[model samples]
Target: MYMNTLRKRSFQIYADHIRPYKGRVFLSWIFLLFAQIIGLVPPLLYKRFVNILSSGTSMDTDISMLVRIILLVVVVYIVMNICYRIAEYVVVHYVARIMADLNQTCFAYLHRHSHQFFSNNFAGALVKKVNRFVNSFRVLFDSFYWDLHGVVVRIIVATCVLAFLNIWLGVILFVWSILFIFVAFLFIKKKLVWDVQKADQDSVVTGVLADTIANETNVKFFVGSSREYARFETETRTQQYLQERSWMVNYWLNVAQGVLLLLVEFCMMYYAVQLWRQGLLTIGDFVLIQSYMFAIIAHVWDVSHIMRRLYEGFADAEEMAEIFETPHEIVDVKRATTLVVPRGEIVFDDVSFQYHATRTIIEQFNLTILPGQRVALVGHSGAGKSTIVKLLLRSHDVTAGKLMIDNQKISHVTLESLWQHVSYVPQDPILFHRTLMENIRYGKPDATDEEVMEAARLAHAHEFIESFPEKYDTYVGERGVKLSGGERQRVAIARAILKNSPILILDEATSSLDSESERLIQDALQNLMKKKTVIVVAHRLSTVMSMDRILVIEEGKIVEDGSHKQLLRKKNGFYKKLWNIQAGTFIM
Candidate 1:
């Protein structure tokens, strides 16, 4: 029953992708069917030629007819081949288009999932699933069109032709073909479990390898290459074992199918010999029966293989189908509208959140920031400062209460619009493997080259960028690994500056830079902060001293709220103690 559901889902996915190209699919099917029908004519012609030669009379007349028959055979073969070529061309063309569409559709759906979903799944495994989905469609199309469809058509045509000649022989062939297919189907159903398990193990191996490669630097730094190799080897061995077991099942299935074919061949031939001895069959009839019997056996054998391939295709496609059926954790409301942020005011009205039921990250959180207010959230690690920023970004919906921007509930507005009005610079910035100019331009895709350069200059990123041989054209490598930590941060700052939205967020933005570089960036940040509502999440006390307000958070609550001097005046206050601890380090 579970397999039946998976099979239906697999077909549904394929149908949805091919629906737009139904005309092309139909045309291809027609050509293939025409070719299969044309293929049946050759054996009948051969039988006629054999019978004519066997009759012992009229040599001269017979010679001329034999020549004509040979020429006709050549013509038939040429036409049949032409039809086959055309059918193949049409199938290839449409399958290519369908595979491309399937790839894009899967990629788009995978990315639309919530951030938490991505965190739970491996990037490499997801990629493998998508590729398998597209490739399985191609496998299914080939198996059906070239093997299953062709075999079925040939068997039907051969049975009809034989039945016309002799009823008993036709019945024998048709009944045996049906039995062969039924047995093959049973074996295929049984093997599908192993095929799916193998595919899953293959994905696990791929995920482990990708993880190791992505974290190669960390592995090398810790001198754990051997440990990683041992882990990868274990996964590879499991994948290998599953693959071998699946192959053994296929071998056993082939042995069973061969036995069935042998039984049918012997029965048909023995019956033919008995009829010939009784003077009810001639040499021509014998040849025809022999020809059709072999043809039927060949097709039935192909049926066994085709069924195996079809089931394998289903197994591969089911993995991706499962992903497609999963509901998106975040989705816009039916009537959601664009967010309009006229004044950069943000409000958290009695909000609460939790990752899981047992532990609450933020509870009864309430805060209101006026337009153009510069607020800093000072907290120790896991104090919910980062979670607050994430909630504002709508990465996860709140468990209770409301988060609004500019008098509009965020959940009621489009995510794109909300994101468009806010700019964020994270503590650790990850850049694409692209040129510096392109990376900065990602902030505003339509921005001119001049505008990008100007933003880079404002972030104090221009000096180091110009030092590279390619200047702004240099590739940053994956996640900006080629650049220093400070360099990547500057590029991120440049991107945010280029965005120039009404609200700016800096999450320990200057943490990566040296004191000198930090001071220079601080100047640029001051210029950028004017007339903008800025929210900074900082651990360093010096960075928050100039802000209009400081909220010292502890255990998801605001323990102290005041300016630098007001918090210092309080005896043994949380903010004061934190400031004292960090002040000595800053001075040193």
Candidate 2:
């Protein structure tokens, strides 16, 4: 039953990645067949040599005939070796090509995952899974062509040759081969547990390394390097333990396989010797049967090892296959069209969102922002402030109500279309490890160098960017780590300025900048926000005091709303209290 399942999975893998190269694979198979035929010819040539020596010189037609037979064998051996190498060369390249394509497919699938999915998993674990999956083909292909396929072909041809000479010997070989395979299959089923455990352990180690690399700065800041090292060591020790156990078990299995091979060879040799004494076989036939017995022993050992390793590799690759089978949480509806937000109006009516069923972040939220209005959301941390932004962005859909842009439901629109009209400068600066020009032009990929510089100038980023030796062409380290806090935020602002979308979200965009830099950025933001629908999420009240509308949200409900002055006039309003707190005063 396991064999059938393994075959189906193997077929699926081949159909997906290897089906395109079937012609090359078929040709390789032909080459292997010719090599095997030439291989079988050697034993026959040795048999012929034995017969010629057994007979007197008078029995042979001439000495010249013997030389001709020896030369034929030499030429055939050379040709067989060439064919074997040719088959190996072609199949190996094909495996590499298929592996490359499979990795690409895996990457494309992973990259499309929803933000929620990424949040739930580690990037390093995912990367390790993909690497293991691509590399599994190496072991899998080796066991497949060299041992599994090779042994099977060797057995069929050997059996045919033996049966043509004597039916009794052929029957014995076939029955023994069946039982040998059955025992090996049973052992392989048990090895699968160790295979899966080791693969899982490998992923854990990789995830630990990835996590540390991603947060090295934080660990150093808190002086927790040694603590992290201990955690990593613990995981590695577990992996080492699994590896040791796996190796010991496979060693014993090989010993058992070795014993089985000996038994089969002894039986074959005894019968061939008996048949020769009874005059049913020639001296040449006796030699051929003995050679065939040794060949059978070698084939059984190879097949046993390959079968176990093949199944183990199949188990490893299937772990990644399960990830591919997971459905995307967010998908565009059938016939969904582009959403055009010409007026930049947004509405969220009775919207509710929750990451878990037991805990709610936003409940029955209702809000509307008119065209070209500057609105601010001010609240303490964990008051559903960011949830509102995520809902409008459709990172996660609202469970209870509709979120619309220009009267079109965001969920019903193509994600690309919805994102096209919105531009965001997040609290933490995000940049790729690419040139400054590339990062700025990311907002609009086709933007020219001059256009990128213009956007940088508008965001007050041009002065600092041009100061570098490479200027706009300078490489920013991973996540813009090479740049200062204020500089990174300015570059992000420059990227957003280049986008120039109708709807803008500034989630603490200036939080990292000093007072002087914030003032410069604030001036640039004023020009950028002119006639644009803007939503600002702020902790520092100074950032939102001049907004056209101030929304003091508490527990996802709008507790206070109006202009900065109008909301402050309310005696018991939440907005008034927060305003006074920021101003270093208290309101009862």
Candidate 3:
């Protein structure tokens, strides 16, 4: 079953990338075949020269005749060289182009995948898989172009020549070739599996490193250097052990191949001399066979090497195939259409969701935010607040209900079009390693300089931006690490402001900011949210007190929903109690 799947995937990969260059590839192989045949003429010419030299009569060989033969040989050699070079170039170019297309397709598919796919995968591991897969195309091309096709043609031609001269030597070399191939394949099969295991272990190590760096603040605050290092070392050691084992096996395999080659060489020469002495072959024929035998043997060994390399490529390709072929759990409906400009009415009807096998995050919940209304969600961690945002963004589909935007079912519209009308400000904003202007412009790539500055001003970020020596061009560093929390939040707000969508989602966007920064950002948020459907996930009750309505969520259920004053009047309600606690109006 595994082998069948590998074959199918390999074919799919080839078809996806190689099919476009079929004519070029076919012509290349045809020229390569002709070049291989022309290459055989050199050994034949050398054999004739050897015969003439041994005769000692030298016909006083005509200088012109010798020069002509030498020139002819040189011309054939050059043609062979040029043709093969062209073939190699064509193969490599096609391989590179195909790998690029495959990688792009994989990325596009991943972009459409539901949040669960990303949450369940290690980001670094997936990145490594893509890198390895693209690299494998080069290996695949190298192996097939030079080793598989070229070597096989040369070997076949050489064997046929030897067989016509003497069948005994032909039989011997054929048997040796079969044995050599079998032994090489055995070693390669084992090493390929080992290499894949090593790659997986390496991916785990990389994932750990990514996590450690991403969580550097937590690690440093807890002084967890030793712990993190130990974990990293464990994965590293496993990867090293697997790689070493594979290398050791490959080394011994090459040793065996070398030994077999030496034995074959010795036998071929010995038999060639015997045939010559028996008058079954001329000295020139013997020399020709000997020379061709050496070339053929080298070609055979190279074929074995190429096969081993191919196995490694296949392993990497298979790993990448998983990611490229992964199902997108959230996808547009059949015949999906682009959404018209949104009017900002959002609705969740009887929505249910489960994050894991045993955990249900939301169950049969119904909610609505009318056009131009502002709603705040108050909940503890894992109370389905963020899940609502994810559902709205179509990052994940609802398990058993409907989500709509402006009276249109979200699933019926293309995801790109859906997001065009919605802009989200996440709690932890992600900034690329680029200038501040580039990061802000990411929201609306075509925004003019004046428009960018205007948006920055509205978000209260223009002042600090101007304070920097580079101003808008200042590099934010990795993940905006060079910037303060408030600065990053303002950048995030500026991005949202630039987007200026009909629906706004502030997912604890102000959580990392100081009180003063939050106050300033809050004013910007109000302006941005004007006439838009707004949903705010708030941890601090004070931030959402004046919201048009607040929904208190607990254990995946909406336990209370009302205005602040109305909720405060109900002593038994969760929101009223929470408000009283935060207000410090109740006895501890």
Candidate 4:
């Protein structure tokens, strides 16, 4: 069943990937046919020259005729060569462009996929697949254009010419040609499939090596280098074994082909001698018969190799097509409405969600925040606080009920517009490998330097930022590894401050910071939250103690909601218990 699916998918890829270039492909075929015709003319014209030379005519009498025929052949050869070069150039250029376009389209689709897709596949495998798709076109053309059209067509044309020269020799050579094809196919077909399987196995091994190296830091930290090396060696040995087997099969098949060709050559030579002894055949006729016979036989041999290559091309194409044909699981609604910027009123009416069926996170919860209000969510780990933030951001839609912003259903709004008014700062902030100023500017691309500095000041990041050797020009290493944890957090706050969105979400934003840094960030947060609707997912109990309201979530449900003082007054409440634990007054 898997093999059948792969075969069908291979053909589908050819249809979809190649259909757009049909015009160029057709022109290439036409030029190839013209070149083949011209090539065959040389052999036929040579036979005529041999016949004329054997007539024992005086050279001076036939000089003009010979010269005219030679001149005609020369002219035809020159024209065919020029056309062939032009056609070959165009075909290769078209194929290159098509491969580039195909790679881009595949990558674009990949970019829009949800995070889940990436998590399940190896990064190296994905990269290698795209690279293989790009390289396969050249191989396909080399095996397809020359072998199929050039060699196969030449064989057919030569066969007809041979038959016309002498019926008996033609019949014998034709029988030999058929037998050779059958013999080659018997050995080559199975090996072609084996070769293709070997190639795929090689790609898988390469992908595994890449995936392991990419996460080498984790492996080394865990002291698993020896184990990883052993695993890799095992995979490599398996791939090498398959490759060696494929090579042996192909080598033996070629040997069979060579042996058959030698036998056919000997038999043809015997026929040529027999015909020469008979009165019915002339020297020129024997020459013509032998020339056409060998030409046909050579082309038949070339085509046998091509037939095997066709199978190999199909197999490689199957791997690439599988990736391309995967349907994107998420798609935007047709003509979805854009979410208009509101006064930051948000509502969650009986919302529920689950990343998977067995582990429900948010469940049957209802909440509302009036415009310009600051609301803080406090909870223990696995209390669905982060899930609530994700739902609001529409990273994953709710499984039940409705989420709304200013009474506008979030599902109706376009994802682009919905995110326009939202600004988020995560616990582990991500920073690009760029200068500090450029990184901050990414939050608001059109902001002036002064505007950026103002935002930095607001987030309490500007003082240290300007104190650096390069000031705002300082580079942040990959993932901001060059910056301290507190500094990176501040940088993230500054980015969100620059966005100046009416809606802001802080997801454990101060979890990694020292007490002083957290206090400073809280002060900056106080400033940023003014005149905005703020949803703070707080792990620190002290962070939410001064909020307008607090919601304590547990087991995917909001079990407590009120001002901080009110929740503290309820001694048995979830919020009270959490506060007691954080304050070291209770242990659970």
Q: Write the per-residue lDDT of candidate 1 for residues 1-588, one digit (tens) a residue.
A: 776777798898889888988888888788788888888887787777888898886999889888988999899889888888887888788889999989998988997898889888888999999998899999998898788888889889989988887788889999999998998888777777788998888889999999989899999999999999999999999888888887887788899888998899899889888988998777778777888788778888888788888888888898898887788987788899999988999999999999966789999999999999999999899999989998998889999999999899999998889899999999999999999999999999999999999999999999999999999999999889999999999999999999999999999999999888888888889988989999999998888888999998888889889888899999989888898888876633
| TM-score for candidate 1, residues paired by index | 0.96
Residue pairs whose backbone atoms clash in candidate 3: 58-61
lDDT of candidates 1 onward, in order: 0.89, 0.84, 0.83, 0.80
lDDT of 4 by residue, 1-588 (tens): 676686686566555778888998899888878888877787666666777888889888567667877988898899889879978887878887777777887688778665567777776777777776656655676787776677667666766776676675667677777787778777777776677777678777887788677667779999989998898898888888877887787788788888988887888778778767876667766666677666776788776677677666666766777766676544467878888865789999999887877778887889999888888888778989888888887767789999999999888887778778899999889898999999898889999999999989888889999889999999998778889888898888999999989999988888878877777777788999999998989878788877898988888788889998999899788888777778862111
| Tens-digit lDDT string for candidate 3 (169-287) | 88878888888888998988888878878867877888999999988999999999999999999889898899999999889998999999999989988888887788988888977
Provide the lowest-lDDT 10-residue window in model 3. Answer: 579-588
Return the TM-score for each candidate structure. Answer: 0.96, 0.93, 0.95, 0.83
TM accuracy, model 4: 0.83
Q: What is residue 520's positional error in candidate 3, in angstroms?
A: 1.4
lDDT value for candidate 2?
A: 0.84
TM-score of 2: 0.93
lDDT over C-alpha atoms for residue 60 of model 3: 47
Estimate the overall C-alpha local distance difference test score of candidate 4. Answer: 0.80
Better of 1 and 3 by TM-score: 1
Error of 2 at 338 (Å): 1.3
